[model samples]
Target: MWQNLDYVSERRADTVMVLSGDHIYKMDYRPLLAYHQEKEADVTIAVMNVPVEETHRFGILTVNRQGRVVEFTEKPKERDKGTLANMGIYAFRAGVLHECLPRYAQQYSDLDFGHHVIPTMIAEGYRLYAYRFDGYWVDVGTIQAYWETSMALLDPDSPLQLYDRAWVVHTRSYERPPAKLGPQARVARSMICNGCIVRGRVERSVLGPGVYVSPGAVVRESVVMNDTWVGPGAVLDRVIVDKQVVVGAGVQLGCGNDVGVPNTTYGDHLRTGITVVGKAAHIPPNIRIGRNVVVHPHVDEEDFVSYGDEVPSGETI
Candidate 1:
């Protein structure tokens, strides 16, 4: 039910936050919000120390010897081994937002909070507190990240659970029946959302609502969003398709692929192999989307688009 609403921060809240939409983890904001209130800080950010190898793409923070904020960099070119990274989940005081964002928009019109606002606050001597987060966290910003994060849900040792009676991971709903498998359907260790018809073999995948996998289709290690149709004998591996995309019969996506590269046309990831397909985009049937591909919205037929394809709006591909 909460899924229908956009993940953007609400207008009426005293604090506005920017959360990652593709993450599979669940967290209660009360503790972090309460801490921010207690500190009476201008901004409180939730941070976690990612591995040194993965810090290149994240907004890294630096604290002085006493843990007071000293510097913040948005995706620094170099990494310090033990530095903390901002999770993009920011809690900002409404007054700070009103005072800063308007002036912010005048300067860096295209900048987001992570890229501009947070760093600006640190420069202005705002009381920026860092709240260390130790619970389960996943960043599903790319195809590989999506695949890995979704697969993590199936692991017994995974800290994230969808079936938790107390805290449910709610998403947009179609209010349809549970996923139905045909007599010959073969499914294993996958997440099948509501309103899906599984008549094929799906292994280690995340299937969103209204996903229709035709008979003989095999999907493995992939993420398929809502209203997607996989025609008969189609196969998907390590690929991510946006909403309403259709795979023509016998289509092969992400097959014979490496973990961090997408074959479909899309932008390059800060870290490679995270293929991103923007919302409401389309992928033609029989077309092979390669690894690490970044596909923009509104792609039409026509373009050499094997990988990293961009479809401009108001124009056919």
Candidate 2:
């Protein structure tokens, strides 16, 4: 926040709002700003009630009955702290923030809001208050979390209502033609974005713009990105294919059931039974890719020839 001091001052802004891009949710900041003014708070931190078991994943807050923040713990392993998790949304009094942050920057090398700023401000008797927000917010920082959140959009009763015209969600999009489906195409419970051409079976998957599913191919429980081509007789299951990739004819991606095997290169990150094909990678014809496998970015068909038609589970190409 201190880094933008000059810009904020240039704009003559009174209250500065900080938000996290990785989180997906709908909110109106007008009410929050109003609450901050009404409470005459120096900093208003938005918080939500998360599950006690999941408290370790967030910055827990202890607020009094008056909703003034008393304590702040960032990503605590122990859940003894309250379940009021920080949503990383803040409305700060610009004048107070401008004066306070620079002094702290001189003291701390790695200054973070949850770890440094909020905790120190509370200790110093700053008028930091908690704004309770009961809304659907998700931090999709990891691959599993991203996939789960995307899948949640398929639910009819999902709290994250993208269909709510009152609060519309805007996204970056490209100019593309209408999505087409061949006579043989069979789709069920899936999202086919504009410019996609489906000629085979797509079940419970999300196909991005301009994706092409060829005849006799099957895409199941996967997320295929923009302009990717699924060739004839290929099958993709529980996989994530990145942009502008090609799956050669008769290739079987994410085929095996060895979900227990972690990725050899990224054991901690890619061990959740998800095969990730990086951007612009090519899968060779008649090749079989296993669970937890990672096809690195820009890996070409010639690279797959070295694997001899089968990329084993837990391997990184």
* Cα RMSD, each candidate: 6.6, 1.1
Count of backbone clashes, every candidate in sequence: 25, 0
After superposition, the stretches of candidate 2 with alpha carbons farther than 4 Å from their true spots are: none
State candidate 1's TM-score. Answer: 0.72
| TM-score of every candidate relative to the true structure | 0.72, 0.97
Among all windows of ten consecutive residues in candidate 1, which has the lowest summed lDDT?
A: 308-317
- On the 0 to 100 scale, the lDDT of residue 246 in model 2 is 96
Model 2 Cα lDDT, one tens digit per residue, 117-223: 99999998999899989888888888888778877877777789888999988889899899999999999888889999999999989999999999999999899
**What lDDT would each prediction earn against the true structure?**
0.71, 0.91
TM-score of candidate 2 relative to the true fold:
0.97
